[model samples]
Target: MNYILSIMPSLFAGAKMTLILFFWTLITAIPLGIIVSLGLLSYFKPLRLVLKFYIWIMRGTPLLLQLIFIFYGLPIVGIIFQRYDAALFAFILNYTAYFAEIFRGGFQSIPIGQYESARVLRLNYWQTLTHIIIPQVSKIVIPSIGNEVINLVKDTSLVYVIGLGELLRAGNVATARDVTLIPLVIVGIIYLLMTGIASFLLKKIERNFAKWK
Candidate 1:
């Protein structure tokens, strides 16, 4: 109990870093993913092929390797980043690919007849997307996006591979110092709390969108 109390500050600090990574990654990745999805669906064959290959590479590789490459490999080529920056960069890029694919799937799932109907109603491309396409895609993608959000929470721990002092790293430090697993147990609880809150919020959003169905 005393040891747990003693380690609380470090654990909290580490958790703060973890949250920072998670939020920024999600905030930035979603918009970038949307753009990538657009590129994937574009009429330009070269652009579509390139975007598809990029998504394939990102999804095929482990994020840890991507983090290592961004943090270490980039420095070798004279493009250096701070630890946090490198981790954030890798995370956003990696998750953007995943989210782009998710969004693309959602977009494709919409029937062609919907677009035809929108055209018959004289809606411009932007209006059609804003009024008809996006709402439906949002509904289709919410559950998948929720799962990805939860995965992002766990994936933040991988930042430790790059020597960033995120939540799992804090637990590891305490465990090594005290030779006990209590810190790890506490860290697990913290993760569960974080994911639980996210799940609750996502469920509410899902419910709100459910009205559209």
Candidate 2:
């Protein structure tokens, strides 16, 4: 018990970094995704094509490669981000593509008649979106978004590849030094707790949205 207690400080520090990356990535990515998804649905052929290409690149490639490219490869082209910045940028960009597709599907699922009805009600574009469209989309995309949010909890570990210490990295370091997997077991438990809490919150959000249906 004392041995485990001794490692808590380092482990908590690593977990703090992981949580920061997870949160800022989502806060930035979700709005960017809403924008990108709208771009994907835009009438302009050029804009659609460009955004499509961007989405294809982001979604088709592994995030680890994206991280390496943004941090390590971009320096060749005069673009450089600090380690944490690179991780945040890559995660936001990658997850934006996914969330864009999810939002696009949600937007498309909303019937056209509703728009016409909103029009008949003299609701302007912003009004319709605010009062009607967004609420429905919020409900529709919750499950998919929940999945990604949970994945982000695990994905935080990937930042270690860029030499940013996170929970997994801290655990690995302690394991190597102590010649035991105890640290790893602790890391696994922390991850499980994080995901479990996320899942519970998502369920609550889903239930709240279900009232709309």
Cα lDDT of candidate 1 equals 0.95
Lowest summed lDDT over 10 consecutive residues: which window, candidate 1? 204-213
**Off by more than 4 A, model 2:** none
RMSD of 2: 0.8
Q: Could you tell me which 10 consecutive residues in candidate 2 have the lowest summed lDDT?
A: 204-213
**lDDT tens digits, residue span 61-126, model 1:** 999999999999999999999999999999999999999999999999999999999999999999
Q: Kindly list the per-residue Cα lDDT of model 2 for residues 50-79, writing each as its tens digit.
A: 989999999899999999999999999999
Candidate 1 similarity to native, TM-score: 0.96
